[model samples]
Target: MSLELKDVEKKVGIDTHIHSTNLKLEKNTINILLGSTLAGKTTLMQIMAGLDKPTTGEIWFNGENVTGKEVQKRNCSMVYQQFINYPNFTVFENIASPLKITGVKSDEIKERVGKVAELLKLSAMLNKKPDELSGGQQQRTALARALVKDSDLILLDEPLANLDFKLREELREELPKLFEDRDCIVVYATTEPQDALMIGGNTATLLEGKVIQYGKTLDVYNKPENLTSARVFSDPPMNIAEINKNGETFKINNNNVQWKSNLKIKDGKYKIGIRPHNITTYKEGNNSVEINGKVLISELSGSESLIHFTNGKLNWVSLSNGIQSKNIGEETKLYMNIDEFLYFDQNNRLVNHG
Candidate 1:
């Protein structure tokens, strides 16, 4: 019970929407496809579901080639960003529709539908039509439909993206448990970083039609393979600046910051990467790289704050705990841990993993 895509590529006229992709999705675990819109997450999922034909390569399910198979022949289910349910049918009927088509016993359909609806918190709306339910309820009904059917593969294409923050959070928390015991392959496609983090699964980070990185979610985030992978996995976008090695000192160009490095490299240009959270308010007794800057913008998101500032010409950002009190044009002191830095070469390849 596995899904494999080998050298799968999708082309729209002259434009290649998905590059040659090779992936092996294991069973009983959620595999997340994380990327921005137009990054080819949906395109890849569609190919896997038999909804779209690959321009090249093959799709294998459980070691059997399933390329060019019709959607009906595949034991798969899909949920999209928009809520999709049979508007004319009651929630219970919608959930049982798939089973009914397969000539499942009415008694079994009722049991499965009831159990899934309860898990998705749609038990109370069993008798209501989709039009009569709220947005969240309608989506839940669709999810229940998918869950009721014993599909070996489930594709969730940003199913929670259209919901409110509160509802999305609630569902995000429940989804892991919802599929825990199901011995199937679940692939969830999402653009939000926190959504992938909350789901706690293996992640395939896509960028511009290619899978930039694929591994355990935290492993990929903490150690992205390259600049493209790092950029796609980043939430606020990692701060990057050109740097040059000058004799014994490495200078961050465009900013008056210099540090001594022991790494043996040619005295040439490079790029330095640092995440926003790594930058913080300056503190004494810490072996921190200090910098002076003027605040440009300050935003409070719940208990945390994000501060954007500039050290003369080079702009930087810092994400700090608690609400940051600062005004635009105010002078501020910032610090970065000496060890919390990534150095990249001119080709955007990570050179140092400090």
Candidate 2:
């Protein structure tokens, strides 16, 4: 009912792919591995599924050590970013292949496949081949195959990465509900911050080969344990600026911009983080700071405006609610609510406001 990785480390010819990762996941929970490319998400998932052996630690499942266990001996399933399906076989056959491999009775195989296909909305398409199915349908077929096995551990390595935006959105919204009643531990890996938020599960933020922070999805997003976790959990990567804090106010380093901080802290240097959505083209709150910037780029994404600009020596991005455009090099002013700023100490640890 539980999977644990204890002091796990994976090194390939001196290049450490997974560094000292220790994590435990319980059944009926979805865990997200949130990181960018080459951030060791895949390598970690491989280790968990027994596809790759950890170089230095033990893997325990249900209190038994299984570090060196062959993947075939474990009851686990993996779905990749690619919609891998047997083109020559029908959707029902593809879903039942795993059970068929274990020599399940014909009646049980039919029942299991039918139930999983129905849950995945593939019942009507059971007679069709993979080549005839839509991209989303093919992916769902692959997922149905995994679910039909009744796996104790499910590892999804960015299963929706290759689908269209609409299909991806649809699947993301349905994923949590699909796992609501399952008794397995689901670990999903993704590079997009938005995907992790919509999944609404526990998350482990990865950077390079190290896990920076792990906690409940919303708790980790709202209160990142450190600056690295905050940046990894943000879509455009959270904006950072160094500042010098005096008794009552903090001044942006190497700039004339200054603002009052009600935080009680020692007089020293620190870094402040600003999420893109906290900045607006107009004043939004009574206590706000104004920053004048030279526009670098303006991206209109549907109903939102993502503006990248430079203030003093630092580059910042502002995400406004509506259609707001500015030409490159044009001077613009954005207002940021003072309370939304995340204060980090010199050591990169987030400082809580008192």
Candidate 3:
């Protein structure tokens, strides 16, 4: 089975919510829509789920056109960022409601719901109302509802966004394992780049209303097709700076920092993209370049020290491993590895360094 979007576009009057998009997702594979808020992840997923119709192009499901089909007529399940559970019903009732609507046998509903609840670790709470369950339990109930339906397509729209950090991490690790044996097309949408990476699937990075890049999650993360995709995939916002390359060396514009480079690109002006984790307070290797900046903000997250600093006019962030404290307005030096730089042409397309 496959879900294909052919030139699908969604526009409300003159404003476009989803730019023309085309993607084909095969069965039994997890696909992630990775983008920030207002990046059209929801709009695109709605079109795929038949909750919204595309203004242009067709949506094909297993070779049959399903563009205009009502969501109720399709065998698809959706879990939202919100809990979205029936507060009045017990966990079992909430999970069994979909089966009841489809006229499944009572005994079979009991069997199916029982199994799904156990898998989601909700078996002990089958009789508890939604009001009595914790946030994570409520969300899991919603997910269990979706899972028991045996949908041909499952769309999870930032399903873990509202959960606590511990719960989110727990579920994120369990999600892939939950769907490992399911024979359905799983589509998960999230703004967190870390979520997409941990999910381990093909990812389509969205920017504004357009899909910037779509490929294997790590491949797209490691080799983003353009600057927009790179920025979208980065959590702390990737650092960018304009530079001029003359032969084997490039100099940062507006700064005296010059580095000898081996990038196999044309010698001209280009924007260089650097991930925050690559910029650390300490040097990593023999080729690490040192550049000093004034610390604008410094905070610790767990074992990492997030140092936000300003070098000239550019605001850069360094996510250094371990605890390194610094006060604001303090002078701090950052080390950047030149080999990890991503070069982008004038049009923002990534220039291959190979």
Candidate 4:
């Protein structure tokens, strides 16, 4: 079944939590609600789940208006960031709770619970209590409960966020596969840009209670509508700085470095956006513009390194592959690929390279 919201807005006293927005979630597809905290992801989900009512606007499911309906009337299952389970109940009992509440036969409940447990690798600990399980196992139990319900709408609110890095990575890879054959709408909320990319889906990027951009994940990531959208979709944030454009020349850092491009535009001031990964230390001749900067911070993560560099008053970052041993206060050569630059107008709207 499909779910849709029309002109939905949420307000608390004088504060607006979710601005007027409209969205239609397609069936059998993963829809990613991508944004940082207080971006209205949870509020929106709550509205749809009937936990909170929208101050205005309507909600529709499969062409029927369900705005005033209760969550129990909609047949939806939700898994929250924290493990929501009965502390005194065994994992098997917790997974079987929903089915029992709906008065499903014991035989069918057993069959469904067993299949979901095996899928989540929770079969071995079905008899254990919540406190006896590890963090991952506890989360798997929550997921199993949700899956066993066989609800048409599934809302997962950062279910893997509480786990350790290695475990989160493992679950992120496993989640999409878990719902492969389900004919339902899955809405997954996350605060990380990498998480949205990791789970390939249509993404709705929210900012300050507004839906700034919504489209296929890669399209929105590669071509953000404006600076806010770009910042919301980018990790490490996109390096931004004011630049002067004159004829075919674009100058940065008071013209200490000049990049000449064939794109024609009005001579004025604008902001330039360059991704950290697009900036490298290797020199590739005229295709790249080289500049000198002092390293302010360098962080090594696995086989990659993130370097924060500053040139005078200007600060930027470079994400380099392999191990980097650059130290603080060290001078380094940074090359930015001119071809990869995204030019935005003074209003921070992506206008044109020409």
Candidate 5:
């Protein structure tokens, strides 16, 4: 079933927090709500799952208004970051608890629970308690419980945040598959950009309780609505620099930088943004605006290396793949990716190119 949020606004007190926002989730697709900590990711999910009421606005499911519906009344299952499983109950019992509460037959509950456990690789741990399983296993049991309920909507709140790197990778690959062919709309909230990209669906980016940007994953990543939205998704973040448009040329601190396109200068101050991967390091170039800097720190992570260069007053990170520099104190020349630069006005709004 499809889920839709219409002008939903939630406020804690006198402050007009979480303004009226709208979002829609297509049926049977994984819609990832990507944001950082305290970004209202969980708050929005809670409102959608009927755990909390919106101070203003409405929620509709399958074209029907279900705004005031209770948590259990809505066909939804929420899996939190912490695996909330009964300590005394075995894995099978935990998975079957929801079914039992709904008055499903014993035989059907056993069959459904067993099937979900096997799918999640929890079949062997059916007899084990929550304490007996590993962190990943416990998460899988929680996931199994959610799945066995046959809920129309599934809400995942940073479910993989506590797991080890290896386990996180494993479940990241398998979790999406769990909803395949099923008529359930999965709304997953995560801080990891890699997870959102891997899940690959409609993404809504929230910041400070506001829905800043929402669209296809790639489009939102490529063209963010504003500076804050741009910095939100980019790892190593987008490099923001100050620039001035003087007549036909763009100037940066008395130096004339080549303009990729003719820009209209309505404002005195302008912000330029570029991704780290888009930047290229050069040993020598007369035409390029040269910045002399010493390597402050160098970090190598297998295929890619992150080098921090400090040029007295300025410091920037350059991302390079399959390259290592041992010159920590030695000065090196840095080149800016002029072609890939994004221009923004003083208000932190992106300047339209076309």
Candidate 6:
């Protein structure tokens, strides 16, 4: 049930598309492929699923060479963004179609369909046609169909895109449970960072048709390899600002910003990154990078509030819980967590200070 793509390269004539992409996936765990639009998330999944062929590489599954194999020959099922259920078919028939295609007996098909239906909570909608069911239900039916096939690999391409926010949230929590105890590997592709966090397993960050980083979920988030990968998972995105070294201290906006490092710097230029949640606002502080600014906007979301502050040409955001303020036009001072700052050299590469 394990899948591996070794030196997989896909090209389109003179254009070299995916360049030497290598990935190793273990059995029975969710591997989320995260990227923005047109990042080749779908292309990589398609190659592994046998729907598309790699230009100059091989696909190995369970120690067998399955390259150039037809889609049906590969023991993989995919649930795409578009619900591929038949409008004329009932939910039960749609879920049972794969089983029937493989020549499963009528009684066994019913048994497998029933189990999958209950797992997806589509037992009550089995008799309803695809047209009669809601969007979420149709998606569940599509997933149930894949489950009934007992495929060794499951490929999901933004399967929750069509569902409403609440439904998407519920399914996000439920979908992972369906893979438990199964001998299959699930490759879920998503453009949303929240989905990757909620799924919580091995993750690969794909950028421009290449997987730049792949490791445990938290490790990738905590220590992103470069600026591009760092901004991928950040909400408001990492705030990057230029810094100038003044003797041993780094100065930002002509103010000495304290850095928890003793490394010597003959810097031409350096950039510092800080996440929004890592910043805290204070009225007055002794060792803080204080700046005066007017509140641009305050967004309240019941439990927490996100306040955006602007000081001249510089903009920053702060997070607070249960704190209310009306200072859109008033002056305010802000403080940043210097200890949580990340530094990058002129090449835009992370400079680790140990």
In model 2, which runs have C-alpha deviations exceeding 4 angstroms? none
Best-to-worst TM-score order: 3, 2, 4, 1, 5, 6
Error of 2 at 215 (Å): 0.7
What are the TM-scores, per candidate, against the unseen true structure? Answer: 0.94, 0.97, 0.98, 0.95, 0.89, 0.89
**Better lDDT candidate (1, 5):** 1
Worst lDDT 10-window in candidate 6: 282-291
Q: 20-82, model 1: which lDDT tens digit per residue?
A: 999999989899999999999999999999999999999999999999999999999999999
List candidate 6 segments past 4 Å from native: 13-17, 245-248, 253-269, 282-292, 322-330
Instruction: Indicate which candidate wins on TM-score.
Output: 3
Name the candidate that leads on lDDT.
3
Where does the lowest 10-residue lDDT sum fall in candidate 5? Answer: 282-291
Could you tell me how far off, in angstroms, the CA of residue 2 lies in candidate 6 after the best superposition? 2.3
Off by over 4 Å in 1: 246-249, 260-268, 282-286
lDDT (C-alpha, whole model) for all candidates: 0.88, 0.93, 0.93, 0.89, 0.82, 0.81
Per-residue lDDT tens digits of candidate 5, residues 202-222? 788878888888888877777
Q: For residues 60-175, write the lDDT of model 3, one tens digit per residue.
A: 99999999999999999999999999889999999999999999999999999999999999999999999899999999999999999999999999999999999999999999
lDDT, candidate 5, at 89: 99
Say which prediction, candidate 1 or candidate 2, comes out ahead on TM-score.
Answer: 2
Worst 10 residues of 1 by lDDT: 280-289
lDDT (tens digit, per residue) of candidate 2 on 1-354: 999999999999989999999999988899999999999999999999999999999999999999999999999999999999987999999999999999999999999899989999999999999999999999999999989998999999999999999999999999999888989999999999998899988999999999999989998898998999999999776889999999888899999888997788889999999899888898877879989989999999879999999987898899999899899999998998888888999999999642
